[model samples]
Target: MMGGNLTGTVRLTRLALRRDRIQLPLWILGTTVLSSTSYTAVREQFPTEADRVTALRTAVDAPAILMLRNAPTGTSDGDMMAFQILAFLAVLAGFMSTLAVVRHTRQNEETGRSELIGSMVVGRHASLTAAMIVTAGANLVLAALLALALIGNGLPAAGSVAFGLGVGAAGLTFAAIAAVAAQVSQGARAANGIAAAAIGAAYLVRGLGDAFGEVQPDGYTMTSAWPSWLSPIGWTTLVQPFAGNRWAVLVLPAVFFAALLGTAFALADRRDIGMGMLAARPGPARAAAGLLSPLGLAWRLQRGTLFGWAVAIGLFGVTIGSLAGTVEDAFAGNEGAARTIRELGGGGALSDAFFTAMLAMVGAMAAGYVVQAMLRLRSEEAGGRVEPVLATATGRLRWLGGHLVVAAFGAVALLLLAGVSAGLVAGLGNGDLGDRLVDLGAAALVQAAPALIMIGYVVLLFGLAPRLTVALAWLGYAVSLVFGQLGELLNLPQAVRDVSPFSHVPALPSADVTATPLVLLGVVAVALGAAGLILFRRRDLAL
Candidate 1:
């Protein structure tokens, strides 16, 4: 009976692998490249043992830096590189795994694919089992590639293997969590959201633990608070990759993965074919007046996601802003600390530079929201929901335009809220509420131009190649973040950096604001959006 439950899992896994050939390779290769590039960049930036040691000391002393990155465990080059990039890589791995699991499991059920497959000699658990297998295999591949890349970059084999294993473990843990979420949520969107929220919560918990960590007697290393132990991401860092090479820490995530996988399988056994453990609430029998139009329906679909992003972004802004006034005071008498802060955010008044850097990060994140919102078009089309809507009086252009409008306005609203949230906190802290609020608000609004460009291009992709929209849109955003934000640290040339739209956005508050770049970006956004609308109007519905 148990064997029958997993019948056809191998074939299903093969089918899944074929379906995800492009996406899996992109995620694996992108993560490997980012990790390897960071190692090279770290070596270039801190060319000597003494320079790396100084960096460790500065990082240990700075709580804000600790909250954003990993605590250093040693002063060696490999240790410093892991400290610089491990936490981020772990989060990336988590995303890669969760998306893969949810896509192959809940998404297939939502589209009736699982039901169709199940009727034809496939076992009840085959689809989910296959998803887990494919995603787990992808993570293993990612780990192997990352290890090889680091070893090729002159890092020791042991530390490189530890780094890869840590990342892979985090991915496997999240993939299991997502497997459970798929069985618990009524729909693919909710399942993905739940898993993504888990990822965000893990990152936040890890940040809290690191921020409150204790600096060691050596002054170059620190011990994270207990909260870090609760997060898989933190567990990955606890491996200490190149620092201590604590291979035993890998067991924590492995246990977590096992427990969650068991729970997922149990839940799958209990639940009905197309139902979730947490059933959806029934809507009113009568439709609301707001559901009458495309715009209203768009708002209905996007509002929940937009609200979530706003709250998250606003809280992040508030946290960073509250620290703004104290930034200068934190490193006041230490010229080395001040210089390090400058190197991180560029030369300016310490507080201004910090604010500028935070806002720039906020800006990059806002683009992600835009991508999610636009990808809903692909979801609707692929799920066969768009055909029914188009059969009505609604025109194709009008339907696409409705979602675009929400994405555009939602992007701007989020940026404004982030600006206001940060400015309000910083102003209150510094006793300059009026001036800070106005300036930071404008600075936050400035980010919208680049984010608009992201929306335009994603929509363009949706129109041009509906099948590739989801993967290509996210890949483009990742490319922008790497080049635009990390270019300086990576020693990438200006020509290469220019590929990201964000590289052109004026880094406000720290530098003088410029309008020419914003104007050009706006023009490009408009042109792309117009082209997409026209193309979408002419193209057949993907379903």
Candidate 2:
């Protein structure tokens, strides 16, 4: 007889692969491109060992840089590249794994597909087992691709392998965490939120540890305290792929993954199908006074997410701002680094350039939330929740408009929080609170235009082709992210780079603010949003 609890796992695994053909390939391709391109760019940027060493020294002393990237192990190009991109790659892998796990496990359950499969030859544990296998397989594939890409690009094979494996291990760790989170939350959305929060907390812990960590003369990196050991992401840094390849460090994540998987399976056995380990509590017998309108309902649905995003993004801003003093100190006497900083900042004060980049990144992150907020409409429709609301006096436009308003204004609020937070921290450090707050806040606001434009594009897709909204919206975001963040580093063609909305945004504080592009972007955003609303009103709901 087949394994009692995982009899149909193989079949489900194949089915999952078939279902995820497009998504899986895209994830793999994106990871590969980002890794290879980052290595290539770093190698090209610092052609000589002397240049690499100088860059490393400067970066290592900058708290902001260390927080964002790992400390360099040596002056070698591979080491520097690892320092520059490994943390980012690890985080990316974690994101991919979390989404993959939740999509196949909790999401399938929410859609009632798991029940259908269970009614067949599938055993009780079959679906979760299949999901784990598929996600783990995807991580392994990603690891292989990353290693091959790095090796082919001239990085040492052993180090490349270690780097790839470390990243893959991180993915597996997060996949296991997501599985546990799935067992804890009743709804797919809640599961995803929990998983995402875990990922964010992991990154934050690592960043905090790294920020306060010291790099010794012997090339050993030490965190300020033991907090680094608390995070899987932090464990990846200890792997030190190109530096020393601490193979023993790999054991940490492996052990954690095993424990998390065991806990998840145990929890799964305890919960009923379509339920979670934590029982859902009943709401109030009567709706709250504020729950009388469509806007109120939308706000209630979105408030938790909005607050989470704000707090996370605000803390990120504070971290970035707090590092400004260290950046200024580190680069003050380094001519090569200063020149590079000026060029990157688009020809203004180095601090301003840094703020400009930070603001841009915050805006991009906020755009992701904006798209998710807008897509809540599609989610509600698919769940048959929107129809009931529509059957009320609430018109389709009002229901849709309520979500759009939240997305638009929510994006603005997040940007403002990030900017003001960053500015306040930096100003307090430098003793210029008032001026810096106004300047940085305005810069942050400027970034909102491009974010709004991205929202408009999503709306256009949602209205014009509802089925393709999620895929197309995310694809667009990925393209924009790569171009906006890496275009200059990769030396991508200006024409290709120009496709990102951020390309049109003035590099504020570094470059003089021009109203023309801002005006054009604003006009386009309004026009696209109006068109989307109009089209959405005419088309039948996808549900």
Candidate 3:
């Protein structure tokens, strides 16, 4: 412990809680509500044993539902319900934990608050200790809420507890992972990015395991290639909450937490505050020609992110493509489900409906791509990186427009891939090979305008409140996400549903595709972009 002037830690703790109280509730409550709502609705709709059997038969064959929900094969309907809901909740907890950890630790250190406190009587690792304690407490609350919500929704106590523990473990695991990331990054955003990448990897690994969990032969289940076992998320899913009630599986994330956190604290003891074990390389003595313009500077900042989105969305498309055939099999022999799928697919066929949903999911992901590009406005301005650019010859509109180019074009790139792949897979499954690519590609392109609306919101926030811009943009997106997938199950307020841009997109495949929402979103985006540039040009840089 530094044990110098120990006064500020309590005050800082209070301030941090005050700042995060609303945010913490939103993350936790949104997760709980989403999970419980889905559980309750599914349970109600499929109350009879026969209902579960039919639903499982339908879902097990439908690859879209299978991939998204990660429904366990050959399990009870109740077990399938747990599987569908818990996977989503685990992800919510993991990401929220990372956000909380980075917000308190690395962000504090990056903003110089830790230096002021290091001069105080606090222990050397007091900030790290505080962050862990606060996050751990939040996780306990989440675990308790999850347990209560599930049990209250009429799930058995033991299975509910197992579900809660699995989620809590995921939160703790990512918190420890974030701690290590915080120790090695100089800035909050970089630390967050690294930690988030770990979370994304965990999901991919877990999803792989779930996807690979097919049973074979004389009573032994075939294991996924070892990649699944290595992921904490994968371990969480394997808990088998209802069927086996495998509570012991919770130990894995705890062991991971102990090891990761110990290493992080040991690393903390070795490095000075604000400096990582790995030092950053120095930048060039002079700027590159592209780096000299406001547009150039914006591109420099966003290039890494754009590249990442491109890869991620393309992969997402590929994943959906691979699953199309599996889904075709799931809805087999279930005439009602099959017809529903086809009608949704337009007057085409059942395969078309499934293709439309797959494309819609990818379209939503591309929206995510656009949001990242939009959020660049806040990052550049907040880092004081955009200041020098603004002091130069570049107009604010040109600066804003540069990033918008990536958002618009990058979304197109993502969706174009999605449409082509969806068509390819659907055609292969149904032997309608010729028109698949072009039709699906056109469907995916129609989704871009609505997705870009989120980008507009981010830019408007940056123009209005540069500091709160990122927070508000992310909060809005999170809310939209909660409403989008879970809306029907949750019985969410109509106003809430209306807030999401995705609400406007036609449920193609079955519903008539329309140009109204797409046109409206495009007009809104342009208006917001113009407003942001106008306001940014007039404001003084806080620096």
Candidate 4:
């Protein structure tokens, strides 16, 4: 019999379904909707061979894009359509799978729910098995929905199957990875942290490999450098679904998953229930100076996230900045390509439009950190951990203020860092570091205040509507992204673009800073943050 298997898996399955009925279905629905939306948008953008060829030429020559999306295979243009989104979609699929599996295994054990079940006649491997099965089942549904969505949109039938299978294979492989992680960690939080780290590592690996194709410049044949083959994101692109549809590559992930599943079972057999093969040290009973208040506690919980955001945004700044010289070259050398880049933005001027476009996207990406950090306060409160702090001498306003300190300050920091980094690099390329850095930093910060306003709303939602906060806030971000980036490309309604704070931000590189728009956006942020804190103070704490 498999270790960690329990006869109660059936009961646990039903129980798990009941608990996740809304959340799981919502996740599935969101992915399905997004996939459909992407399919429609991509198809519309590159409907002809000429459009595809131009895209391939621009993308292949651009290291930034190749780093972002896998290199196109010079295959059919229609098949190449999937290239635009395959990286992100694969990452999302893998992340969702790892999260779902980790939630059932380590997270459940962390909360002691798994222990409660472990005390029942659960077999050694049943809980993990049942969890994997359910997770795999969810992947299947995703696969079906994804395939149906693509094919329904007129994608080739075989290519759609390959696309869906690639997604499912990624989910399965990550599920197996989480299974192994669950066996090594003493608690769910650690397991979850580890799995998330793994997921991130996978993305980084794929990015690196995509940037410098699995081969090294000085070619020593680094076997361990096989991150490309190791990452499912890299593997999915190998399928080349919309093009030649390399069907056999799909089995690589499937086989890797089988191997991982075998290892997870072996590890499970060796470990005791609710315990890992590795021993864990107990957390300090005494509080640190940083843990003294609600906001501080929120900071303690969220500091890792803040640091990560700063680093990522800064690097992204470097990338965009480094491309500044390249943009000028393209502007001078190639009119057709420049127009395409311009079509991508600046109505006409190549460099200014490019910077404006890059700045807007980077600024938007900065919110990924803000939204989650803002919502962290709500998670603690709803999870029953905040009541004890509130019962103490802490006032609700001060507590809320602490987390807000991180959110507000953190957003400002990211914008400045991103701008400075991008500007410094871009300016250096133009041989004027001092002036360039100042220009980039100023523009980046100009947009930062309004970005803060959006972050404030995420926090507000958390305080006022805990259950709906995460989804609604992220949805708002998506709306902003669409409006800021594609509103012009898609010719979306004027009212739709007007809904985002960013749509109002003048392309500062091309236009001088105007105080009216800046002041209004700043006021919005202030009001939203104030309202969130006030509401939080008035609301009842959970438990």
Candidate 5:
């Protein structure tokens, strides 16, 4: 009987792999490249032991930096690199794992794909088993590739492998959490959101632990606080890749995965097919006034997500803005570091330049919000909700326009909120509260133009190739992010840099405001959006 429960596991695993062939490779390779490139840049910037120590000291002295990045165990090249990049890599891997699991398990059931498969002589556990197998395999591949990349960069093989395994363990832990979330949530979206929230919470807990951690007498080493023990991300960092290489730390995540998997399996047995452990509440029999129109319905669908993004972005902005005062003090004697910050931030006073760079980074984050907001259309269409809506008095164009309006305005609102929060914090200390608010607010708001461009391109993909829209839209965002953030580090060509809409936005406060790029970008965004709407109207609705 147990054997029968997983009878089709192998075939289902193969099917999952086939579906994720492109996506998995992209996730793995993209993560590896991010690590490898940062390693290269770190090596170039800190050539001597003293330089590396100074860099480590700079980070150690800054509590804000400690809260954002991990506390270093030493001043070695590998230690610095891991301290700087590993946290981000772990988060990325966690997201990839959670999304992969939910996509295979809950998403399949949500779309009725699991029902069709169940008609065959397959075991009840086959789908979940297959999802775990595929997600686990992807994490393993990411670990191996990342380790190899580090080894290729001349790091010790043992430490490289340890770091890779640490990241993989973090991802696997989140995958198990996602499995349980899948059992509890009625819909794929809620499952994904729950798993993602777990990841975010883990990161925050780890950050708090590091921020309040005790510093060693050596001044270059520190130990995380007790909060670290509660987070998988903290556990991964405790693996201490280059410093201690604590192989035993990996056991925590292993135990976590086992416990979560057991709970998920038990819950799976309790839940009915196409149902969750927690039942959805019945809605009002009559539609609310806000649900009467396409625009109203779009707003209702997106408000929750938008509010979440607003809070996260606003807090991040405030955190970054507060750091503006510390920049000069931290890098006072380090001309090389100062020069790099200046270049990133643009021209003017050192503090102004810092704010400029921060706002630009904020702009990139806002663009992500745009991508997610625009993708809601695809979600609606894929879930068969669009048909019922269109069956009403709504036209295709009105429906699409309603979502687009929400996405566009939502992006602007988020950016402006970030700006206001950041500017408010930054100006309070400088005694230039009014001036700073106006400048930074405008700088952040200008980001909306490029963000809209992202929306247009995503809509275009949805119109032309509905099936490929999700993958391609995210791919486009990743490419643009690489171009905007890493172009200087990678020494990418200017022509290539031009491909990202962010590259065109004028760096504000530090540099003089220019209207030409902003105007042209707006024009291009309008044209792309118009073309997408026209094509969407002409194309038949995707089944």
Candidate 6:
């Protein structure tokens, strides 16, 4: 019976591979490139044993850095690189796996494609089995590539393999979690949201445990609490790839993946086709009074997401702010640390440099929310939801304008919230609230230009090439994020650095704010936006 239920699995897996060729390659390539580049940069930055030791000492005392990265395990360059990139790599792998599983499973069911496939000779479990197989294969490939890249960069082969396997295990665990989420949520969006929340919760649990964990006298070994064991991300770092390479820690994720996969399959067997195990409740029969206009409807649709982003960003700001003093104290006497900070911050006051980097990070995060909001237009159009609305008195311009306004203004509000929260927290710690609030708030606001440019790019894609908008929009954001954050570290070419809009924004607090670049960026944003609106009004809806 089980064998029959997986009929046509190979064919379906092949089909999925074909469909995701571009996306899968991009995900793998981008991750590998980032990891490899980061490793190379770290090696170059700290060339001697003394420098590595100093960095390890600094990282040990700084809780914020520990929360962001794992405690250094050894003075070896490979160990340092592994510690620096493990958390980031684990998160990336989980994100890739979640998106792949949800896109193949829940998204297909939502669009009725799975139903069509089921009507053929395929069995009940074939589609999901195929998706799992393809996703697992992609993760394995990513793991192999990352391992090979690490070895090619002069790292130990055994440690590289351990790191790669740890990352891959995290991805597999999340893929199974996403599969279970797909069975529990009624729609693709909701499934993705649930999976994302799970990922976020896991990271938070890991970060909290690491932040409070006890470190040995060596300043390299750490012993985390029970909360660390609860998160698969934490498991990845616990493997300790370069220092001791705790082979047993990998078993945690293996067991979790098995349990989650079993639960997903069981849930799938109990649910109806094109529906989830958890049924959604029906909405009220009458629309609310505030749902009269397109703008109101847009707000109604996006308010939940906007609220979530605002809270998350604000909390993140506060957390980073609270760690600023610890970071400064940790690096006070270290010349290598100071030089590295100056180089990364483009040379300035150490405290200002730290804030500048934090604000830039917040800006990148805000761009993600802004791009998501802007992409709602493409989603509505693709789902055939826009036709009915346009069939009424509402015109294309009004509908587009509604979402655009939210994307723009919501970006501003979220940035302000993050800035204010960080400033307030840091100010209280330093005993000067008013001045810190204004300065940090202005810093966050200056970073908004990149997000605005991101929206402009998405709008342009939606109008000129609606079918390619989603992929290209996200690709643009990813490029900007990588360049903006790591360009200096990687010693990337000037032209490459210039590609990101954030690169033009003067690093506030660290340096004097110049108006020329800001004005140029604003002009470019307006031009792109105007062109998009014009093209959207002229062209017929692709759907």
Q: Write the per-residue lDDT of candidate 3 for residues 1-543, one digit (tens) a residue.
A: 345322455666676677678777877887887777777667666677676665555544444554566646334545866655667778778878888888788777765677777776677777887788778888899989988988887778888888888888999999999999999987677777787678778877776665555533422223334566788877777787776777777778888999999998899889988788778889899889987666676677767776876677677766666666665566566775675456434445555677677676777677766776676565556456666776788777888888877677777877887777667866786677577676777778877766777777777777777766656676777667667655654566678777777766766554567887778878987887778767777877642
- For model 5, what is the alpha-carbon lDDT of residue 363? 87
**What lDDT does each candidate get?**
0.87, 0.81, 0.72, 0.71, 0.85, 0.82
TM-score, model 5 to reference: 0.90
Q: Which candidate has the top score in lDDT? A: 1
Against the true structure, candidate 2 reaches a TM-score of 0.91
Q: What is the lDDT of residue 318 in candidate 6?
A: 92
The candidate with the higher TM-score, 4 or 5, is: 5
Provide the TM-score for each candidate, comma-separated.
0.96, 0.91, 0.86, 0.82, 0.90, 0.91
Best by TM-score: 1
Better of 2 and 5 by TM-score: 2
* Candidate 1 TM-score to native: 0.96
TM-score pick, better of 3 and 4 = 3
lDDT of 1 by residue, 276-301 (tens): 99998888999889888999999999
lDDT, model 4, position 92: 64
Q: What is candidate 5's lDDT per residue for 226-326, written digit by digit as tens?
A: 99899999998999998899999999999999999989988999998889999998888998998989999999888888898898899988987787678
Report the number of clashing residue pairs per model.
0, 0, 13, 16, 0, 0
Alpha-carbon runs more than 4 Å astray in model 5:
63-69, 211-221, 317-344, 425-432, 489-496
Evaluated at residue 190, the lDDT of candidate 3 is: 71
Tell me which residue pairs clash in candidate 2: none
lDDT for 439 (candidate 3): 71
lDDT of 1 at 135: 91
Clashing pairs in 6: none
Tens-place lDDT per residue, model 4, 163-242, is 88887787788888888988997755456556655666776687766656532232211111355777877787777777
lDDT of 2 by residue, 450-473 (tens): 778877888888889885565567
